[model samples]
Target chain A: MSQELSDLDRRLINRLQDDLPLTQRPFASIAEELSLTEQEVVDKVRQLRDDGLLTRFGPFFDAEALGGAFCLCAMSVPEERFEDVLTKVNAHAEVAHNYQRDHALNMWFVMATETRGDIIRTAREIEHDTGLEVLMFPKKREYFVGFRVNA
Target chain B: MTLDPKDRAIIEATQAGLPLVLQPYTVVAETLGIAESELLERLENLKKNGVIRRIGAAPNHYRLGMTANGMTVWDVDDSLVDDLGDKIGALPFVTHCYRRPRALPMWPYNLFAMVHGASRDEVHAKRDRVAELLGDACRASDILFSTRILKKTGMRLRGQKG
Candidate 1:
């Protein structure tokens, strides 16, 4: 849990997320609107990231639109092999985010590929490389999982 | 980070709808008239550059029986946000968690978490667990359960005219 953001930081980030200006000097545009310098805005964003306050700053994609397939996969990697499995899993560009959970299905990750073949191929490859069973649960019906960072 | 014509084409085509076939990449390659390996390599490069976040299935959780989902916000102590966020994010029910700038004059809660379950009661149970974990450090919280899904899709980086 965290306290509220400062007025300046809140406005800057809200503008950034809601409608990132598409201009040559995007930061400058944002800064002008916020009554801050472009450098200040950039610096604040960098600081927020360094403080681990910002998960990430950028565009989110629609996986289905890309002709690729994706699924939420999990596995229980032996403690001794956690690092090895993590390294191999992270090596694949398809893995968006992976975490070590506190459960029987400890390791969980998201995998996406340009095509269905690539999706299956990459999953199998990871299984072969890590020697762990990857349980993939693809989205059957999507419900809204809003990413609005509430600012 | 700049994409060439071929790379843009591949992104546009695949983002449109990767052919649902045994050899989807091959279809993309054929349309692009390049080797499959080339297409693969380009995708790898795009991902490496962070131009594309991921290539995966965006599951319709509601269709799979986990219909209840809510955006739970917590007023966590600023000093403990990082550790608490990591712990909260590690929960299986919490598919997404992040620290966003707090909403002004309307919503003051900063910490946010999402939980999904088979039913509203299930989601509420999970929320109770989170509330217990959070304890007194939280000042206020709210759950905005979704009533409708607007739209969902993958990346469309190329088509938008800058």
Candidate 2:
């Protein structure tokens, strides 16, 4: 539960989701909005990172346009080898994210590469590496995840 | 959609992050020997064209105290998926919703929607709301929580080499 967030923390989460003002000392503007000192805002943000309140800060770049393509791929693993397979699959530099879902396609991971061929190559390599059939669910269409879950 | 040399360089310069300074874009522009306006214009263009999703802080939900995140998968009738997906995606609690392929017998779900909340029960309740919305269109579904982040990196920037 998001039970540990402070009042200031919740406000920061809500406001920071928007792009920070493109000014020198962007934190200053944010501080003004929250009626806190610039140093306080900066310190709070740093603390949030240390506390894991923020996963990332800065421009969110598009992978496909940046000379690379990404695909959401998954594999069904035998219970005995789940952890072992996860290690093997994640060892590849191309694999950016991996997740265990409650479905037959239980083991899911995202593969990114400079080219589409590279994406396919890595998918095959993951199959060989894990001794499991890697089901490639390349994205045909993607919808923006603009979900703003309030704190 | 690829960027020209200048655009590529600009992206490369700020790809890591905008230096948390007074004039972050200006700092990037100075390094590239381009006017700040030009750099800003290109960024604006990129945003308009959907190349850059946004310029903001991506806070970790778990850290922000809203930790229960579930990847809710739905097996809706093929014909009704897109229509239903739009509705599901629009839910304030649901952040990402999309139509993914069904792997059949084993992977029977095709539509995916991500829901987040303060607790697992909160997420489960949201899932129920989505299920009720789908009604008979959704045959079955399940939720998957991410266990770990094996690797984390930004987009693969070709500008690094070029």
Candidate 3:
């Protein structure tokens, strides 16, 4: 929470992840309901994005529907080679999230593929190219974890 | 209009708790006083327009026997991120991977991944595999197991009151 946002801002953000108003005057309709002008609503949304409070404002597609498989994976790299390994991991479009943590296994990321075979193939390729062991932990069961950041 | 009144109503209703029946659509249609065909058509349009991503179930993993779910973070090289991210994202078990701003003060990891398994040991074994794949660039990594599960649901359009 860097700076306090107006009530209208919060409401707009809450709706961003959901179905956006699918109308010619989507912003205006939402504004009317929230008792704010369309311009004001748009302005607030832009500000929220700029503030980094909103990671993304769009639909979260069902990966399974597309016949894609996803899971979490991580690896512990020597402190010296951290930068080189990071570049190698982020090059792939399937790698959605990558972060650093405070532990022996300091780096983690998520991977999704159209098929299980692809997931394995990609992991093996990375290991071959980087010459580091990539710990592949496929998700056996998925527990939804919703992350919300206040603006 | 991207979503009509009826379409909005349908989305609001089924955002969570999809009817658990063979003809869930029919039941939802009857409740909304719309024909099943009409409901299905609207949903199709929404999907085409990228409004509603998809209609599916979000199961409770813990109940399904996956007791351990951990967030694995990595510190990947900036130059290799795009290449490695694409390969990592292709993994079936590697769900939901994306680039995020790193946390400050001692934590400098840039790659993040998640794994779900029956037990903690299973997750650790998978971690070893990922480590083998990452090779020299991987400086360090760690897993933060979920201690508790909070509210889990589809997107909520109407903000909840405090």
Candidate 4:
């Protein structure tokens, strides 16, 4: 269920998505732009995060630049062991984003590790752990990344 | 180039999220026993090196009224992948796009582009546009609308729990 959002909240979401001033007084600068007090802007930001409206509010790091390996892996688990497989796959610390999709290659997850070999090894380990065939789809190239989302 | 110990420290400190304050650097640096100016300088350098993509508010798509999202996969001819992937990635609504290796029989889609919208119908329309763009070079395709997100941690190093 979606919650009813206020006009201020909508404006905040659109504004905060970009134009985050990098300054000594970032919040104060935002207040100046939005005509609200620094404290009010700060409080609303806190509330948005608390309400799970804003997932993150800080430095955005790209894994590839940090010498880390990131790839998407999937598996087609039997329906009888779906829950059991989900629990096992989700338990790993390296699983970045796991999703239950509507296809035969259903169980899809993003795997992040320190090395390229880890991407291959993790795929094998997951297959062994889940007793299912793992299809590793490591990114060969990135055409575009971190594109601006529509506000 | 290797990561400086100081840079590593700074990233670890702000990995979760930075403080919501006037002088966030001052607060973060004070905790790390460093000067605000010094932290700012390092952050600037990191941004230049592409380590830090951005220092801003990363809004949740669902909260922003983008309730429908799908990962559109395509099996395009290898010769035209570079041409096709770039074209699809350039779409305004495509958030994330990449070319990945395909496993035969089971998985034939090598190109992946993320499609998101306010409704499922909207998502399908976007997918059709992509398909039309791919044309005959695209041999096969499939879209996997995420039914559930079991786990999601932006970026985590080995053995590091978020």
The residue-by-residue lDDT of candidate 4 on A28-146, one tens digit each, is 76688789998899889988888888887888877777678887888898888999999988888778899899998788898888888888888887888988987888779888654
**Candidate 1 docking: what grade?**
incorrect
Q: Which digits, one per residue and each the tens of the lDDT, describe model 2 over residues A111-132?
A: 8887789989998888888778
Worst 10 residues of 3 chain B by lDDT: B148-157
In candidate 2, stretches whose alpha carbon ends up further than 4 angstroms from where it belongs are A1-6, A21-32, A36-47, B148-154, B159-162
* Pairs with backbone N, CA or C atoms under 3 Å apart (clashes), candidate 4: none
The sequence of per-residue lDDT tens digits that candidate 4 reaches over residues B45-96 is 8888888877777777887678899999999999999998898998877998
Tens-place lDDT per residue, model 2, B1-162, is 668888888777877766654456778889999988888888877777767888877767665567678889888898888788888878888877878888877778888888998888989999999999999998898899766565566555754553
Q: Lowest lDDT 10-mer window, candidate 1 chain B?
A: B149-158
Judging by lDDT against the true structure, name the best candidate. 4
Q: What is the C-alpha lDDT of each candidate?
A: 0.64, 0.78, 0.59, 0.82
Residue lDDT tens for model 3, A30-124: 66778877777666655655565554333344445423566656677788988788788767666666766555656666677666887788778
Better of 3 and 4 by DockQ: 4
Residue A67 lDDT, candidate 1, scale 0-100: 42
Assess chain B of each prediction and give its TM-score: 0.81, 0.89, 0.78, 0.89
Order of the predicted models by DockQ, top scorer first = 4, 2, 3, 1
Q: What lDDT tens digits, residue by residue, belong to model 1 across residues A20-95?
A: 4322344666678888776777677766655545534433344454345666666777988877878898788777
The docking quality of candidate 4, as DockQ, is 0.62
Candidate 3 per-residue C-alpha lDDT over B1-162 given as tens digits, one digit per residue, 9 for 90 to 100: 344567668766666544433345667779999987787778767688656563322323443355676666677776775566655655545554555445433456677667667788987876677676777778777777754321122324432224
Model 3 stretches astray by more than 4 angstroms: A1-151, B1-4, B150-155, B159-162
Tell me the TM-score for chain B of model 4.
0.89
